[model samples]
Target: MILISLIFMNVFAITVSLLIIVADKVMSNYGSCKIIINDDKEFEVNGGTSLLRVLFERKYFIPSACGGKGTCGYCKLKVTDGGGPALPTEKLILSPREMSSGMRMACQLKVKNDLKIEIPSEYLEIQEYIGEISVSESVTSDINRIRIRLTDPKTIKYKPGQYVQIKVVTDEGTDFRAYSMASNPNRTDEIELNVKRIPDGIGSTYIHSLKVGDPIEFSGPYGDFYLQKTHRKIVCVAGGVGLAPLKSIVQYWKDNERHRRIELYYGARTIKDLYDHEFFEELARENENFLYIPGLSDPDEKWTGETGFIHQILERKMTEGENSEAYLCGPPIMIDAVMGVLDKGSISDDRIWFDKF
Candidate 1:
């Protein structure tokens, strides 16, 4: 009698579990959904996934640095209709003006109903490319400079200072991470990127593991941080791996002979971390119009260059000019500190463009 009772109870528990699973599958399924893009293009996607994933799967790449995590605030899209109230996660990143203008983070918004959204016309031109690692070398203790040769499209055109998103797949799932193109934009058949390894970072770890001949996938030419077309003197400040895009800009200037006065200020913690220091130094010596100032915050005994934060050197050496524009890339705190110095020098907010990673 006791054995029979135990068997009955176990059967009851298993039956209830099976029913719950069936119900969940039936309830969570939302058949199909329509996503109208820019009111010009439309796609039929399976509902219940984040807008970011749906768009990417359809080849409408949206720039997202933090995968679909809603932390990077890079995947904002204007949702015209059927996008429910903004999620609390989005509120953390969207500005009051952006929210009022219907800007929503694609990563946080789920597509349950038919949706109408707007994508920039330029975004429609972005394409995914398959490439293979041609060169991979360490630039610093934690940073690597990787070069990829495009195979499928065979070419790409991007502006200096723009970034690309590498698709990373792991047991956790698939996601994309953004890295600024360090190669000169003129190199259409290939590109270079500098990646700094983060502890347990899915994208960086995958990139670090890549070797020559390893195939990779990425989408590109995103971000408005590229150099502007103006006659103004160029002032660039970079910290550590932030040098990637700045290096691209400098190379473009050299290749195109856009001979406006340019000053580059780079900062790092130690001499070892100051990758490409010699390259910039050589360029500075050869080009009378180009100036390179590399500063070390925590220098080793062998250091003999600028000893201090880059901002301090800028304060001393930066000459205030009415027709000057500033470009900065670094940690948020470093960017904030440099912008303060630029403000004191009478550089207006419009004249200063920064990418804080």
Candidate 2:
């Protein structure tokens, strides 16, 4: 009786597997379709694939921080026609105005037929670059500063504060993670990234395990989170490795000798986490316009300087509405706190910029 039951179960499982296979053969066969990008470029791709995957496969990489899970809301494109209805996921991330303007999340929009989508002109210029790992040194116990030298193009032109997406292959599949470039922008042959090892994070683990001379491929110069062209006093706020892009911006300013008064407020849990304070301190010493303020949330008894939250320190130090523009990069909570402080200080929202990771 037991053998008969086991046989019946096996038969049922086999039948279900066969049905799934047949369904896939019929349902997943979308044949060939045309993808018209920005009304200028066109490509033939197989239908029934996510627009994000199709674009990535064709080397037209989109900035997707959540690897096409539709969480980051970074892979948005204007679908003028033939994209079908927007998915619930897309609606969640997109504003009502954005939806009315035909913007949809590329990751959720499956290409069931010929589609017309418009991407940014800058995105069209983004290309994959091959590089070799030149340096991978630990900045802190958990954070590693990786420097890579371009091997193929030998040079990459990018604005300061832009980020690149590093590709990593794992047992599950390929994953891409974005990291801001920390190196001086004047050096076009190489780029630097500061990666904090997150527990059980596939991309960070793979990157941390890489050795010198290891090959790496990444696509980049993405994100609108860069310093605006202004002579106003620049108030830069960073927490932890959020300093990466700010470092690039500051280096660019120093390298070009841009005479802008800049005040940097860096926040960390303790003094040990303030890895690059000395670099900024030296800059402050050399340039009267550049001021470096490092604040510790939790300081030891021997430690001195600023204590408590960094946003509080910023509020105490900065004058309200002094024709200054603010740039912030940090955790969402910290960004919110800082924004509140900036608002109270009469800094308009238009003058405030932030990147929340």
Candidate 3:
């Protein structure tokens, strides 16, 4: 009698599991769908996938640092029609104004039906490229500079200060991380990036482990952080690896606009943390208009150039912020502190652009 009871219970459990499987298949199926981009191009894709993945499969490379997890706000796009209300995860990243403007996180928005989407015209130009690692060397104890030579497309056109998203494949799955280009944009055939090792970070660890001839896939030239065409003086502030984009910007200026006045204030914890110091110092020596200031928040007895945070260094040296364009990149707290200094020095908010990562 006990054996019969156990058999009955097993049958019941199997029946319930089968029912759940059938229900999931029915509910998850959404059939075919269409995506219209800016009323210009259209794509036919299978429904039920997140818009970010679907667009990427179609070669519309969207900047998603969180790998379709809806954590990074980089995948925001305007869905004019057929997109349902914003999801809660999207609300955490997007502002009220963006929500009202019909902006939605591509990673959170599922393509249930036909959708109309709008993105920047520049996004259309962003394409995926395959490259081979040409140079992989350590910049500091934790930072590495990796240079890749484009193999497939062979060349790329991007402004200095823009970034690229590299695809990292691990045992678990694949992920994407954005890195600002450290090399000058004019070097179209090859691109360089500065990656600081983050403890247990998937992207950084993969990058640090790369060999000289390893292959890589990335898409790019994204972001609007490039240098603008103006006669105003340029003020750059960097902390840690945030100097990547600024290095690109300053190199571009040195090669093209030598007459423009540019000042770079770099902050680190110690002298060893200040990598690429000699390059900026050489630029300053070559160009009278370029000034290099390295500051250390915590220094040893031998340190002498500047002591204190980068904001403190800027506050003491920035005499004419008026008619100057400020470019800042660093941690959130550092960017905020430096912006406050730039504000007090007469720099308008409109002229101060920052990228905090």
User: Which candidate's TM-score is highest?
Assistant: 3
lDDT of 3 by residue, 1-357 (tens): 999999999999999999999998888788999999999999898788999999898899988876777777889999999988888898899899999999999989988899999978889899999999999999899999999999999998999899999999899988899999989887899999999999999999999999999999999979889899999999999999999999999989988878889999999999999999998889888889999999999999999799999999999988698889999998999999998898899999999888888
| Candidate 2 lDDT for residue 113 | 90
Off by over 4 Å in 2: 1-13
Each candidate structure's TM-score, on Cα atoms with residue i matched to residue i, is: 0.94, 0.95, 0.96
Task: Estimate candidate 3's alpha-carbon lDDT, on a 0 to 1 scale.
Answer: 0.92
For residues 1-357, what per-residue lDDT tens digits would candidate 2 score against the true structure? 999999999999999999999998899888999999888999999898899999999989889988888899999999999977778888899999999999999999988899999988889899999999999999988989999999988899988889999999888878898999988889999999999999998889989998999999999889888888887888899989899999998998897746888888999998888888889989889898888899999999977789889899998887646688998999999999999999998889999888888
Q: Which segments of candidate 1 are over 4 A away from where they belong?
A: 1-23
- What is candidate 2's local distance difference test score? 0.90
- Which tens-of-lDDT digit does each residue in 1-357 have in candidate 1? 999999999999999999999998887687799999877889787788899989988888988999888789999999999997888999999999999899999999988889999999889889999999999999999999999999989999999899999989788877789999999998899999999999998999999999999999999889999999888889999998999999999999888746799999999998889999889989999999898999999988887778889889788889765789999999998999999899999999999988998
lDDT (C-alpha) at residue 309 in model 1? 90
Which candidate number maximizes lDDT? 3
lDDT for 101 in candidate 3 is: 90
Alpha-carbon local distance difference test for all models = 0.91, 0.90, 0.92
**What clash count does candidate 3 reach?**
0
